[model samples]
Every structure is written in C-alpha cells, then in structure tokens.
Target: MSGVAGDDPRDPAGETKLTFPESWQVESSDGLSASVMFISGLIMVTRNRYLAWPSLLLSINSVINQHPLRTKEGGNSPISTVILGVSALLASYLPLVMIGPQKQVPLPVPEAQ
Candidate 1:
C-alpha cells in the first residue's frame, strides 16, 4: 500500500507529535478515576443517595473525553463504542439522584454575649 494519509495507522507523516504526560499526573488521574468508579459502583449498589450522586457525576466527567465521538475523524474504536452503548443502556434504569443538601456542615455560630 502506498504511504498515503489514510493508509497508515501510525500516521508517520502527520503533524501530530508523540508526547507523554507526567508520570505522576497519569498515575494520579488513573487512580482517581478508578477509585471514583469503584466507590460509585458500591454506592449505587447500596443506593446511597448522597455519595452516589457525586460519584456518578465524577464518573461521567471522562465520558466525552474517552468517547470515540470526541476522537479525530475516521478514528474508530469498537470497544469504546460497545462500552459507551452498555453504559447508556445501564443508565436508562440506574439513576443516582440527590434531593438533599451536600453541605458538610454549617458555619460555627459566634458565641452570643
């Protein structure tokens, strides 16, 4: 096959550069994301309204970031698409809702004279 723009998976001719993130940043983000999802699953299973709400929100932050729809044109990921479809299907019945305040505590009242 000719070395054409659409022929190469590596895109050796593309202008994009191969750069890596800081190890600590990668590790921390990976850890945080996994922990959030794990805790979210636990909260969801237990139906904890308060914690589940925040966890669900946190877990969704990477949806668009990791989704194939956000990838460059012609980029295809069958696994990603399948995962997204499954998540969407599961989300239809699983709703983590919060109706109460998430505040940790009220400010300490000053002593009255």
Candidate 2:
C-alpha cells in the first residue's frame, strides 16, 4: 500500500473492481407507479376529491421518474397509470361540477341535564 490512492504493487493500476447484479435478476417494476395506481383505484371507488388530486400528482411524478432505457422489455407503462389517475380525478370532480357541493346542515343537539 502506498500513500497515493491509485498505487498498487501487484496491479498496474489500483482501480478497484466493482461487481453489479445481473440485469435479469434486477426488478424492473416501478413501485411508485404501482402505488399511484392503487391510490387512483381508491379514488375511483370512494370518489374522494382530496385523494384524487394528490393521486394525479403522484402519477405525474411516476411518469417523470420513469426510465425507459432501464426498464425491461414489455414492462408496465407509466402512461396507463397516468390515464387511470386522470380518470380518477375526473370521476371525483365531475359530481361536483354536475350537481355542485351540498351544504351539510348539523342537527341541533339538546343540552345535557
């Protein structure tokens, strides 16, 4: 070992060998997109306006973070996730647009004795 970082007696250069996992063994699925899709499904089922907006944003993030080059052949597309998210957003808001939001009236409660 020498004071210089690249100094190696046995080898010509002290460049360290790095081992990477095989490409086939690596997972190509995007967890973010999957979760976003799940959220979209929830929004569709519940028609929650709050969840709809955030789920749409998450879908956009998923699309932006997608790496086509890194993904394996025939991998799941982010486009579908975005489409689902957008549809969920539409479903949540369309009711408000069509019928408008109803004001909730609280029932009067009797005073406790």
Cα lDDT of all candidates, in order? Answer: 0.50, 0.83
lDDT of candidate 2 at residue 53, scale 0 to 100: 84
TM-score of 1: 0.32
**In candidate 1, how many Å is residue 70 off?**
14
* Root-mean-square deviation per candidate: 17.2, 11.6
How many clashes show up in model 2?
0
Q: For candidate 2, lDDT tens digit of each residue in 1-113?
A: 45876465676575568998655433657788889988899888898999988888988888898776677677768898899999999999888799987889998999999
Model 2: per-residue Cα lDDT at residue 7 = 62
How do all models score by TM-score?
A: 0.32, 0.62
lDDT of 1 by residue, 1-113 (tens): 57555676666665576798633222123443456656656654665555654555555654534643334454333344334434543543365343444768889999999
Clashing pairs in 2: none
Q: Which numbered prediction scores highest in TM-score against the true structure? A: 2
